[model samples]
Target: MSVTPARTGARPARWPTGVGRLVAGAALLTAVALLPWLSGTDPALTVLRALSADQDPTPAQLAAVREQLGLDEGPFSHLVHWLGGLPRGDAGTSWVSGEPVLPQVASAFAVSLTLMLGALAVTVAVAALVSARTLYLGSRRRLHRVRAGTGAAVLAALPKFLLASLLATVCGVWLDWFPSSGWEGPQSMVLPALALGVPSGAVIGGLLDQALPAAFNEPWARTWCAYGFPSGLTARNALRRTLAGVLPQLLPTVVALVGGAVAVEKIFNIPGLGRLALDAAMAQDLPPLQTATLFLVLLGVTAGRLLQALRHALLGPALRDGALATLHQPALPRRRSPRRVAALCAAALLTLVVAGLLRDPLHVDTAARLMPPSAAHPLGTDSLGRDLLARLGHGALRTAGVALAVTAVSAAAGLLVGLTARVGAGLTEVASTLPAVLAGLLTTAVTGPSVWGAACAVCLVAWTPYAAQAAALLEEERASGHLLASVSFGAGPRYLLRHHLLPAVLPALLRNALLRLPTTVLVLASLGFLGLGEQPPTPEWGRLLSENQPYGELAPWTVLAPAGALVLLSVLAVSATPSGRSGTRRSGAAS
Candidate 1:
C-alpha cells in the first residue's frame, strides 16, 4: 500500500524562502496586468463594439481609430502593440478623451495617492500601538489573537468609501472642516483624510494585537527577561528581534487601501488618480485604462516582493529551523460548517447575477421609466425601460462579486504585507504613513476608467495591510517556538503557509472577508452610481439608486429592494458566522 506523507507537528517550510508567496504574488500580478490588454485594445474596445450595435459611426472615424490601435490587425498584433509600448513609457493618447493617457492618469494620481498614504499612516500607528498594548493583556493566547483580529474587523467593516462619504456629508458639508469639492487645497484634504484614516487605524490596531503576543513570547523575549534585563531593554529587544517576522503581512494592507482611494478622492472632489480614472472610465478611454491597471498591479507585486525579501533575510533561520517542525501535524477538529456557508453565499450571489443579467438592460420606456410600483412593472422601471428587479439582481450580483473578490484579495495581500512591515517598526511607520491617496493616484493613473482595469489599478494601493501585519505576527510566532520548529522539517514557506500560517489566520481572515462584503457592495454601487463601475444600462445597484432617487418619492420600493438586499445579506452573513468568531474582539490576539 502507498503511504501518505506522515503527519508531524511542523511548519513544513521556513518563511525566509517565501517562494510560495512570491509565486502566488507573481501569478496574481500577471493576471491583473494582462486584464486590460486582454479585454481588447484597452477596455473601451468592448464598449465601442457594444456602441456600434446601437449607432452607426462614420467609416473614416472608425478607420482612424482602428488604424491607431491596429484593430484591423490580429489580436496578437494588438497585444504586441501593448507590450511594445511598455519600455518606451508610451501608452499612447486616449481614444475617447483626446488627451495624453499618461498625463490624464497622472493628474488623478496626485489626489488619490495623498489620501491613501494619509490613511495608511493612521492604520500603521493604530495597529502597531494597539497591538503592542494587547501583548500586555497577558497569557490568554486565544483571547489575545481575537483582540488582534479586531483591527482587521474594524477595517473590513468600515470600508474607505463609506467612511469617506459619511465624513464628506458631515465634515465637508456641515462642519466645513474641508472644502465641498475639487480638492482645492491642503485644508480640503482634512475630511477625506479623516474618513480614510479612522478605519485604517482600527485595522492596524487589530493586526498589531495579533502580532504582539507572538513577539512577546519569543525565546528572545524570555531570554532578555532571563538575563535580568531591564523592562525597557526587554521590550526593545523584542521589537528588534521581530522585525523580520513583521514584513510579510504589511504589504497586502497597502493594496486594500488603494481600493478606498477612489471613494475618498471622489468625495473630496480631489481630482487625484481616482477622479481621473473615474473620468477616463466615463469617457471610455482605452489607453488610460491600460496604464492604470498596470500601475496598480505592478505596485502591489513589487511591494509585496520587497517585503517578502526582507522577511526571508531577517527571519531566515527561525522559519526554517523552528516553525516548519510544528506545521506537519494532522488537521485539528472541525469547528462547524464554514465550507457550507461559504458555498451558500456563493450560490446566492450567483443566482442574483443570473437573474439581473437576464433582465432588460435598458429601463427606458419613457412612459414607465419613473412609474410607481404597480401591476405592470412591480418594482417600476428606471430612467431606462429596464425592470428594477432585474437591475437590483444584477447590481447585487456585481457588487457582491467584486466586493468579495476584492476583499479576499486585499485580505490575503494585507496579511502578507502586514507580516513584513512589523519587522521594522520605524520603517513600517514611515512606509505606512504615505497617504492612500498617493498610491490611489498612481494605480488609478495606470488603469484609467475600466472596471476590471480599476480593480487592477487599486491592487497596489490595496496591499497596505500586508506591510502592517508582517512584523508583529512574525515576531510573535518566532517567540512562540513555532518558527523554530517550522524550519526543522525543511519545508518551504508556501508549504508552511498551506500547513501553518494560513490556518492560524484563517478564522480572522474569514471574519474580515464576510464583514467586507456589505461595504464593498456599497463602494462598487457608489462607483457605478458615480458612472464608474458597470456603465449605463448594466443594472448596477448603486446606479439604480442614483437613477431612482428623483422618482423615489413615487416608488420607494425601487430604492429599498437593492438597499434591502444588501442589508439583508450583510446581516445574514453576520448571523451565519459561528458564534465563536466575532470580529477581533471575540477572537483574542493569540489564536
Candidate 2:
C-alpha cells in the first residue's frame, strides 16, 4: 500500500465549518425569538392572567390590557419592535414581575454559572480518574472489566433528581455533613455538583473505555507503547483522540445536562437560571421565557463552537481528521445474538403489562399499613396501607404509557426533522435549547397537571436530540457513494428514503429511542416530584416516589421499591439496544 503524506494546513472537509454553524445558530435564535407569539397562548391573556388571577376580565378590560401591551398591533409589528430593542441591550420586561428581563436573568446567571462550572470541573476530574482506572484495569483482568462496566452503567442509569434526593438525605439530613438544599455559598454547591457530575462522568468514562483500545491499536500509539512511555501517557493520548472522536456524539449528553439542570436546580432550591426558567415557563411570562430561551441557545451554540475550535487548535487539522475517521469507521460488534436480547426485553415489557392490567393499586387496607415485605405484599405496603406491589405495577403501567406515547411522538417528529435537516434546523435548535423541565412546566401551565400534559411537555423537548441524531446519520448516508449512484440512476427522493435512507437510519433510531426512555422517565418523575405531573392518587412511578420520599426512613421500601424499579427499568431499556459497531449499513436495499 502507498503511504499518503500529511497536509500542512487544510480545513477539515467533513462536518460543518464555523461559518456554517454561525449561520445555523443565527437561524436558530430567530426561530426561538418568535416562540412567544407562536406558543398559541395569547400574550395579552398570559399577561392578564398573571396580573389578575382572582377575577375574570370583560372584553373592554381585555381590550385595555391588549392596547397597554401593544398586542392590538399585528404580529409583525410586535416582532419588529422586539427585534429592534436587541441592539440597545433591552430584553423587554417580565409581564408578571414588571421588572426588566435582563436584570433578572443577569442576577440568576451568576448562581447558574457557578453551579455549571463546579459541575463541569467535577465531571472532568471524575471522568478522567475513572477512565484511567478502567483502561488500566480492563486490560489486566476480566473481572475488572466487568466491575468497571457495571459501575459505569449503574452510575449512568440513576436519575439526577433521584440521585440528588439520595445524596441530600444521606449527607445533609442524616449525616449532617452539608446543608440539604441552598445557594448560600461555595460549600453549598458541592452536593449538587456531585449529583449532576457523577452520572456524566460515568457516561464519559464508559465512552473512553470504548475508545481507548482503538486508539492504542493505532500504529503510532503502538510504537509509543513499545517505547518507554507510561500507560498513562498512552491513555492520555488515547483520551485526546477519543474526545475528538466523540465530540459530535456528546451533543445529546450536553443537551440533557442543560435540560436536566432545571430539575436539579429546583430540587436543590438553587436560585439559578434553571429555577428561573421553570418559574417563567410556569407563569407563561413571555418576555422572561423568550429571554431565557435566547440565552440558552446562545450559550449552547457558543459553547459548542468554542469546543470545536479548541479541539481543532490543540489537535491540528490532520490529527483531528484522523481521529474523526477512526470514530466513523467503528469495528464490527461481537457476534452476540440479537434475538436473545429482544426476547428478554419483550418478556419484561409483557410482565409490566400483565401486572398493570391485573393489579388494583388504589385498594386500601388500613390494618396493613407500613407492613414490611411478606407473602401478602411482595414489595411491602406503603404508609397508607396500599400494597406496594400493586402500586408499582400500576405506576409502571402509567409510566410505560407515557413513555410509549412520548417516544412515539418524539421518534416520528425526530425522523421527519432529521430527514429535512435544512428545513428543521431552526426547530432543532429551539427545542434543543429549551430544557425538558422548562417545557414540561410550560405545558403544565397551559394544560394543568395531567398525564397528557406531561407527555406533551416531555415530547416537546425530547424530540430534538433524536432529530439531531437522525439528521447526522442522514448526512452521513447521503455522503456515501451508493447514494450518489442511486440518485444518478434517477431514484426519486421517496424511493431513496424508503429503501436506502431508512435502512441506514434504523439502528440509530432504535438507539435513540432506547437511550431517550430513561431521560423521559426521569423528566416525568421530576414533574411528578414537583406536583406538576399525574396529580394526586394517580399512582405514576414518579408520583409514588415524590409522595413517599418524606417517609423514606420510616418505611424505606416505599421509596426504594419505586426508585429501584425505575432504575431497573432504565437499565433494561438501555440493555435492550444493540451496541453493535458504528458506521452506516445498507438495510432495505442493495445500495
Candidate 3:
C-alpha cells in the first residue's frame, strides 16, 4: 500500500511588506493630512470659534488666522509642512488648545495605549479560559461546545458601550465596588477594559475553539495520536499549529478594540486618543485630529508587523516544511437547533416592531417619569417619561432596517469588486485597520452629524470584508480542476463566471453577510451612543442607551431594555448561521 505524505507548513496570507508597507503608510498619512480640505469646513472660521467661541471675526481677522496657520497653501502643502517637521519631533499645534499637538497627542495616546493593553490582556485571558474549557469538554460533549459557542456569540454581540453602561451601573454605582467614571486610578480602568475585552475575547476564543479542533483532525495529528503519544503533547503541538492560522484574525480584533475604545473611553470619561480624536472632530480641530489619526495609523501598522513576526516565530520550521494547517473557516455548531432559535428571536423582534407601531414613541408624560414596569408600560418609562417598550419597539425598526440596508449594499459592492478587482486584498488590509468610529468622525466632519453620515461611514469600510472573502473564493474556484476542465472545453470568461463563480460564491457571501449583521448593528449603535447618529427626539437603540445611561442607577430598566433588544438581535443573527458543511468546504478550499 502506498502512503500519502502529509501536507506540511501551510502558508498564511501575505500582506504588503518592506517598501510596499512604507508606501501604504505614506499614502494613509497623506490622506489624513488632506482631511481638513475633505471636510470642507473653513479652517479659519473653525479656529476663530475655537479661539473665542462668542467672537465673530471679520474677513481680515479670519485671513490673519488663516495666514498665521499657513492655510493660504493647498491641502498638499499641509502634508508637506507636517512631514517637514517630523524628524525634529514637531507635530504642529492644536487649534482648540493652542498647545503643542505632539504633547497632547502623546499624553492621550499613552492613556489609550494603556487601556488598549489592559483590554488586550483581558482578551487573551478570556480567550484562553474559554478555549481551555471547551477543549476540556472534548469532542464527545458536542452539545457543550454548542452551548459554549452560543454563549461566546452572545457575549461577542454585546457592544462595548452597552457593556460599559451595565458595568458602571451594577459594579460601579449600585455595588460601589469601582469608580463609575473618570481616570483617577487603576480601579477606574476595570470597567472600560472589561467592556472592550470581553466581547473581543469571545470572538478570539470562538476562532481558537474552531481552529484547534480542525487542527487536531489533521492526518499528522491522528497519526501521532495513534502512535500512543501523550494526549497533552499532541494537543500542545496542535495548539501551536492552530495559533499560526489564528494570528491573522488578531488584526481585525485589534481594530475592533481600538474602534470600540471610542465609546468605551467616552462612557468611562477616560482621556484616551479615541476621545481626543472624537473631541477634535466635533470641534473641527484639524491639527489634533490629524495628529491623533497619525498615531492610530502608526499603532495599527506596528500591530500588523508584530503579528507577522509572531506568526513567523510560531511556524518556524513548519513554515518551510508545510506541516502547519492553513486557517479554517469557523463552523457553526450543528447539533443545536439554531434555526428554531433564529425563528424565535425574529418573531420576538417583529412583535416589538408591531407593538411599537401601535404606541406613541414620542409621547412624553412628565408625571409618569421613571415609572417602573407595569401594565401601562411593558418595559418601563425613561427619565423623560417616554415608554421604554414603545421606544425600543420603534427603535428596532430604525436600527435593524438601517443595518440591513447597509449590510446589503456593502455585500453587493464587495462581491462585485472581489470578483473583478485584483487589488481586493490590499484594499481590505488597509481598510480593516481603520475603525468605523474614526470613519464616522471623518463623515461627520463633512456631512455634519446625522443618520446618513453614520450609515455612509459604515458603508465605507464594511464592504472590505466581503470583498476579501469573495476574492479568496474566486481565486480558489479559478484553481479548481473542474474550472480548468471547463476552460479547456472552450468555456468563455463570462460563461465561467456566470455559471461557476457566482453560484459558488453568492451563498457563502450571503451567509457571511448575515453573520456580520450584529457587528453592523453594534457599529451603528456605537455611533449613536457617541451622538453621531440621529439627533434628539429620535429613538435609536444606541441613542436610547446613551440618553438613559445617567439614570441607569435610578432606573436600570431604562438601559437594560435597549441593551436586551440589541443582545436579542445579535442572537438572531448568530443563530441564523448556515450549517457546518459549507464552512468545512470553505476551509478545505482555503487550505
Candidate 4:
C-alpha cells in the first residue's frame, strides 16, 4: 500500500527531504572527516603514536609518516581523495593497523549488528509482556499501567554501564551462568544484550501501555465490541493500531540502542563498532574513526527508512482514508500530589550524601580492602580499601551537582531559543536525532576526556527536548481563545509574553527539566563509566561502579552501594516532577 501526504492531511515538512536529506548526510560525514584538522591535532604525530607508541620520532620520520598518510596534501585534499574511492568501496587504510579500513570496520560492524539484533529481540519480548499484562488487567488496567510506567521509568533510567556491571557481577561472576567480559561465544553476549535491551524494552513497553488504552477507546473498537466480535479479536486489532502509531519511534529507539552499545561493548569487552569508535577516538586514528562513524550514520539512516516503510504498510487503509486518529490524548489517571514521595526519596539520598561526607574517600587502607560492611565502613571497601560510603557521598556531589547544572543550562537555553524562534520543529527534530554519546565522542576527540567535555557533550543535545516542548507550548498559547481575545483587546507582544506565554510555558518547562535530571545524571555517569567523564582517583559515581565491578563477586556491597544511589536519584527526579498538562493549565489560569 502507498501512502501520500494529501490523503493523510500531512503538512509538508520544512526540514530537508528527498535529495536534500542525502546532501545533509554527506555534509555531516564531511564534517566528521575533517575533525582531526578541526581539533588542531597533528596527523603525523597521531599516526606515529598509534603505529609505535614507544617511538620519539624525529622531524624526518614525522614527514615520512605524513606523506604516507596523505596528510601532506591537507585535510580537504585528503577528504577529496577518500571520497573519490567511495564508489569503489574503499574507505582508505587504518593509520594504526595499516589494513584496509572497510574490512576492519565491516568485521566490527558484524559483531555490533549481531549484538543489536539480539538486543532487539529482547526489547520486543519485554515490550510484549509488559503491554500484555497491562491490557489483561481488566478493571485495574489504568492503575496497573501507572505502576508499570513508573517501574519502566526506573528501569529505563539506569545507565547501561551500571546495569552491565551489575549483570556481570551477579549473573556472570557470582552465578557463573555466563561469561562477563569477553566475546568468546553466544553466552558472552547474554549479559551485554540484557544490559542494553532491558532499558529500551521498558521504554517501548511504557509507550505501548500508554497508546493501547487510547486505541481501545476509539469508536472503531467500540463498534467491533458492540457487533458481537470476540473480545480477544477486538483487543488484537486495538494492539495493531497502537503498534502502527508506535512504529515511528522505532527509528530513534534503534539508533539509541546502537549508541548505548558503546558503553555496553566496552564493559563487556565485545569488539563491536562502538568499541572500535571509542578506541579510534582515543588513539586519534582518523581513518578508522571516520569510517566507523560513517557506517553508524548510514545504519541509522537505513533503519529509519525501513521503519518508515513498515509504518506505512501497517497504516495502509488508515493512511489512505484519514481514519487514523491522534494518539496523544491517552486515558490519564487522576492527578495526585507526589511531593511526599519526592520528599521521602530526597531524604534518603540526602542522608546518604551527608553521612558519606563525614568520612574520607581518598584514604587507602590496604588491610581493610574489600571488607564487607562494618561499623567503620558501613558500605564496605573497594579494591583500594577506600570506604565505599565516602566515595559514594563525594560522587553524589559531583554527579548530582553536574547533572543539575547541565539541566539548568539546557532548560534556560532551550526556553530562550524556543520562545524566540519559529524554526523549532525542524531544528528540534534534527538535533534530537544526534545522541549525547556521539556528541561526547566528538567533544572528547577535541578536548580530551574531562568533566567539562562530558557536560558540553550532554548540553549539546539535552536542550533539544526542552526546546521542542517550549515551542509546542508557545504555539498552543498563540492559538488559545484567551490569547486571541487578549490580543483583540490591544495586548502588545510583551504583555502577552509576560502574562500568557511565560505563565503557561515556564511551569511545563520546569517539569520537563526535573523529569530530565535523572537522564542527565545517567548520561554523565555513562561517560564516566566509559572513561570519558571524570578520570579515576576522583570517586565519581560512574567511575566508582567501573572500579568496583571486578570485585562484585567477591564483595557485592561495593557495586550495590553506588547503584542504589543512582536508583534513588532517578526515583527522586520522577516523583518530583508534577503532571505536565494539569500543572500547565493551573499555572496559566492563575496568571
Candidate 5:
C-alpha cells in the first residue's frame, strides 16, 4: 500500500530533461518572437513587387519586387524585416476598401480588445457573485436553497446574447439608461458588458452548486466540523478544498474571453485584435491575418501556461502528498447502477437541448429584418428581415462546433505532448514550457481568420500548457514506488499507463475540458462576431448581436437569442462539472 509522503515547503516534483522538449519549446517561443516577421513575408513580397514595378511585365520587375520586399536581402535582412520594430500603421493598403490597412487594423484592434477585456471583467465579476450565492445557499434553510436553485437555473438557462438583448431593450432603450451599441468609451460598454457577463455568472453559479457539496464532504470539512468549529468556519475551510478544484475550470474561461470580446466589440464598434483579424480575413490580407491569429494563439497558450504555473505555485506540495497517498490507496469502487447513468445522461441531454433552443435562427433577408416579437414573426425579424431564430441556430452551431473541436483537439494534443516526458525526454521539456506569444499572429497568417484557420491556430498553441501539466504530473508518478513495483513485475509503460495512470489522470483531464468546452464556443463566437469567421449573411451569434445594435432598443431579441444560448451552455457546462466553484460559508458560525 502506498503511504502519503510528508510534504514540506519545497518545490514540487517536475518532469525530467530531454532535448526534444527544448527544441519544441524553442520552436514555439521563437515562432512567437518572430511570427510577425515570418507572417509578414508574403505581404512584404507584394510590397516589393509594387515598389520594383516599372512596366506591367518585366523579368527585372519581378527581381526588383523581390529586392524591394527584401527578398534580395540576405537571410539576416529578412530576419530584420521580420522582427522589424513597431508598426504604428500599415506598410500596405487595404485591397478591399483602399484604406491604409495598418492604422485601420491597429485602431480596430484597440477597440475590440477593450470590448473583450471589459466584458471579461464584468463576466468574471458576475460569475464570482453567482458562485458566492451558490455557496451561501448550501447550508441555508430549505426554502432559500430552493429559491436560489430555481434562480440559478433560470439565470443559467437564458443565453448571453438573449440577456444582452433584453437589457438593451429595457435598460438600454425603454429605460433610456445605457447605450444600445457602439463602444465610444467605457460608458458605452455597459450593456454589452452586462450581456457578456450574465452567462459567465450563470455558469460559475451552477458550478458552485456542485463544488460546495463536494467541499462539504471532503476530509477537511469533516475534520473541521468534528472539532466543534462553527458551520461558517467549516464552510470557509471546505471552500478552500472547492477552490482547489476550481483551478482546472479557470483556463477555459480565459479562452472564452477572447471570443466574447470579438462579439461585443463588433456590436459596440470597439476595435480590437479580433476585429482586425476579422477584417483582414474577409479582405484576404495575409499580413494582418497571420499577425492577428498569432496573437490569439499566444493568448491561448499563455493562459494555459500561467494557469499551470499558478497550480504548481498554489497546490504543488499538496498535490504531491495527495498523489503519493492516492497511489497506495485502494482504488475507490465505482457504483454500478442504471440510475447514475440515467441521471448523467439526462443532465447532458437537458443541457444540449437548452443550447439548441437558445440558438439564434436568423436568415438574411433585408425585407424581413428587425421586426419586434409578434405573431407574423415568431421571435421577430432583424433589420435585414432575417429570421432571428435561424440566425441564432447558425450562431449556436458555429460556436458549439468550435468549442467542441478546440477542446478535443487541444486536450488530445496536450496529452500526447505530456506523455513523452515520462521517459525523461528533453525535447518535450522545451516545447512544454514554450511561451509562444505570437500564436494569434501566426494563426492570422496561416488561415487569415477562416474558422478552420482560427481553430487550428488555437489547437496548436492551446495544447502546450496541458502537455506541460500532464508531463510534469507523470514525472512525479514515474519516480514513485508504485511505478518501481509495477516495473519489477515486468509491467510495460503502456500497460501501467492504461491501467493505472490513465485512471488517475482522467478525472483531471475531464474537469479541465468541462470548463474549456463552453469557453471555446464563446471564444469562437466572439471571433466570428469580430468578423474573423464566416462570411457576411451567415448570422453567427456575435455577428447577429452586432448587427442589431442600432435597434437594440427597438427590438433587442435578435441579439438576445444567440447571447442567451451562449450563457446557458456555459452554465450547464459548469453545473455538470464534478468540481470547480466559488467559496462558501459553513453550517455553524460564531453566533
Candidate 6:
C-alpha cells in the first residue's frame, strides 16, 4: 500500500519578517489610530450626547467638552499620547464612566480569565473522557461511532445563547440550583462554563473520533501487533499520534471559546471583559472600547502563537515537515448518502421559508391565544394570539437570511484577503482572535444598533477566520504541482487564479462557510438577546425567544417553538458539514 507523494513545488514565502514587520506594525498602529472615525459616528459627539442628561448640549458646550478631553487635538495626537502611556500601564480614561481604562479592563479581564479557565477545564475533561471511552476502551462498533458522532454534531451546532438560556431557565428560574446572572463565587462559574464547555467538548470529541481510525491503522500499529506488543502501549502510541494530528486544528477552538464567552458572560451576567466591552460599545465609550479591543486582539494572537509553538515542539520534525504532505493529501469528498440527508434537511428549511413568505406573521387572532399545538396552528399560538407556526417560519427565514448574509460577506472577504496578500492574512488572524460577540458589540457602536448594523458588526470580525483559512488553502493550492506547473508555463496570475486556484479554493470556502453558519446564527441570536439586534415586532429567532420569556411557564411551546427551530437549523447545518460525509469517505478509503 502506497500513500500519495508530496507535491513538488516551492512553498510560498512566509509572511513578511524584518521590514515587513515594521510596516505591519505601522499599519496596525494607523488602524488603531483611526478607530474613532471608523466607528461610524463622531466620537466626540457620541460622548457629549451621552453626557447630556436633561437636555441636548449646545454646540458651545460640546466644543468646551471636546477641548477639555483633548478631542480638539485630532486622533493622531490622542493616539500618540495614549501609546506613550501604554507602556506605563496607562490606557486613558473611559468616556462614559470617567474611570481609568486600564484598571477597568484589568478587572474585567480577571473575571474573563476565570471563566475561560473553568470552561477550558471542562472542555478538557469531557474530551478526555470521550477519547478514552471511544478510542481506548470500547470495541470498534459502527453503531456506537454513529451514535456518538450524531450526538456530538448536534451539541457542537447548538448555539451558545440558546444553551445558556435553557440553563438559566432551569437552574435559575425553575429549580433555583444556581444564580442565573452574577459573579458571586466559584459556583457562579459552573453554569457559564458548562454552557461554553459542552459545545467545545463535543467539537473536540468529533475531531478525536475522526482522527482515531487513521492513527490506529498506521504502519506502526501493524508492526506492534505482529510483535504481540502490549495493548496499553499500542493504544497510548495511537492516541498520541491522533492527538498530534488534531492539535493544529485545536488552536482555533480557543477563538470559538472567546466567541462563546461573550454570550456566556451576557446570559450569566458575569462582569467579564466581554460584558465590559459590550457596555463600552453601547455607551460609545471609546477609551475603554479601544483598550478592550486591543487587549482582546493581543490575547488571541499570543495564545494562538504559543499553542502553535507548543504543538510544533511536541510533534517535532513530523509537524514541521508535513506541510507539503498535508497539502498533497487527497481532498476529502462527501459520500452521497449523507449528502442526500443534508439535502433533505435543506429542503425542509426551504419549504418553511416558502410557507413563511406566503403567510402574514403579524396577524393577530386574540381568540386563539395561547392555544397548544393543534390542526390550525401546528406550533400553536403565542400570548398575543399571533401564529406561532408563522412566527417560527418567518423567524427561520429571517435568521437564515442573516446567517447567509454573514457567511457570504465573511467567505467572500476571506477569499479575497487570503488570496491577495500575506499581510492581510496576518491581520485577519489577529482580528479573528476577537470574540464574535465582542465584535458584534463593537460594530454596533460603530454602525449604530440596527439589523444592517448588526450584520456589519458580525461581518467585520467574522471574516477573519474564514480569511485565514482561505489564505492557507490558497497557499497550498498555489504550491501544488499542477498550479506551480501552470505558473512555470507562463500562466499569468489572473488566469491561474481564475482557472486553477478558484476551483480549489471554492470547495474549502464553501465547507468553511457551512461550518461557520451555526456559529453565525448563534452570534446574531446573542446580539438580539442582548437587545442590540432585531427589535420586537420582527420575527427573528432571538427576538422571538426574548418576547416569549415573560410567559415561559404558562406557554412553554412559545419558547420551545423558536428554540427548537434554532436547534433544528443548527443540527442541519452541522450535519451538512464536510465532516459528515468526508469522514465516511476517508474511512472507506482507508479500509
- Scored by CA lDDT, what does every candidate get? 0.51, 0.63, 0.69, 0.68, 0.51, 0.64
The pairs that clash in candidate 4 are none
Taking the tens digit of each residue's C-alpha lDDT, what string does model 2 give over 252-366?
Answer: 4555555458767876888888778777765666567667666777766666555546654544544333212221222332333345544665676567546645768888889
Tens-digit per-residue lDDT, 1-591, candidate 5: 543333321123344443453445445544543443455554434443444432344566556545544444443553334335336433444433445545665565465456667766876676666666545644331212322233344465444554565676678678888777666667787787677666666555545444465445444445555676666775565455445434434544555545324444455455566556545544334445444544544455565556556655544454444343323322211212234433554565455445446654434567666777676555677787866655665556666666678888888887776676533234433332222222444676656767776566556556743554455445444544455456556677578788656654555555456554655554454445444455576656555655675576667676566555555554455445443212221111111
- lDDT tens digits by residue: candidate 4, 1-591: 111212111221334434433554565567666667766768788778877884678999888988787787776787777778889999888788888999999998888888888898888887787677656642223333343245655675666777888888778988999998878878887898899888778666755664455455444555565677767776666666556544544555675566547778877889888778767776667778777777776776677567656754654544334332322223335345567767887999899889999999999999998999999889999998999999999888888888889999999888875664434433443444455666787788778889989999899778865775565456444544455555556777778788878876776566556545666777787777667788888987767776777777678898888777877776676565654331122111101
* Model 4 stretches with alpha carbons more than 4 Å out: 1-15, 138-148, 166-188, 210-247, 312-331, 335-343, 405-438, 445-449, 461-519, 529-531, 580-591
Q: Over the full model, what C-alpha lDDT does candidate 6 score relative to the true structure?
A: 0.64
Poorest 10 consecutive residues of model 6 by lDDT?
A: 582-591
- For each candidate, give its TM-score against the true structure: 0.57, 0.76, 0.82, 0.78, 0.61, 0.78
* Ranked candidates (TM-score, high to low): 3, 6, 4, 2, 5, 1
Provide the global lDDT of candidate 5 against the true structure: 0.51
In candidate 3, what are the lDDT values of residues 27-47, reduced to their tens digit?
Answer: 766666666677786877877
lDDT of 1 by residue, 1-591 (tens): 111222253322234434433454344334433444443443334435444543555666566656765655644554456668878977777665466677666656555666667766776666566556544432222222332143345354454554565566667677876676776766776677667666656544543443344445544444555776666665544444444444444554565455336656665667765455545544445457556655555555566567656765555554433322222222222233445545665576567556656776554576666666666665666665567767776566566667667767766776665444323332333333233333333344455544554454334434444434433443334433343344445666677667555555555455445644665555555544554355666666655655665444455566666654664565456446543311111011111
Pairing residues by index, what is the TM-score of model 6?
0.78
Candidate 3 lDDT for residue 213: 54
Among all windows of 10 consecutive residues in model 2, the one with the lowest summed lDDT is: 582-591
Residue 265 CA displacement from its true place in model 4, Å: 2.1
Model 2 scores a C-alpha lDDT of 0.63
- Please report the candidate that would top TM-score against the real structure: 3
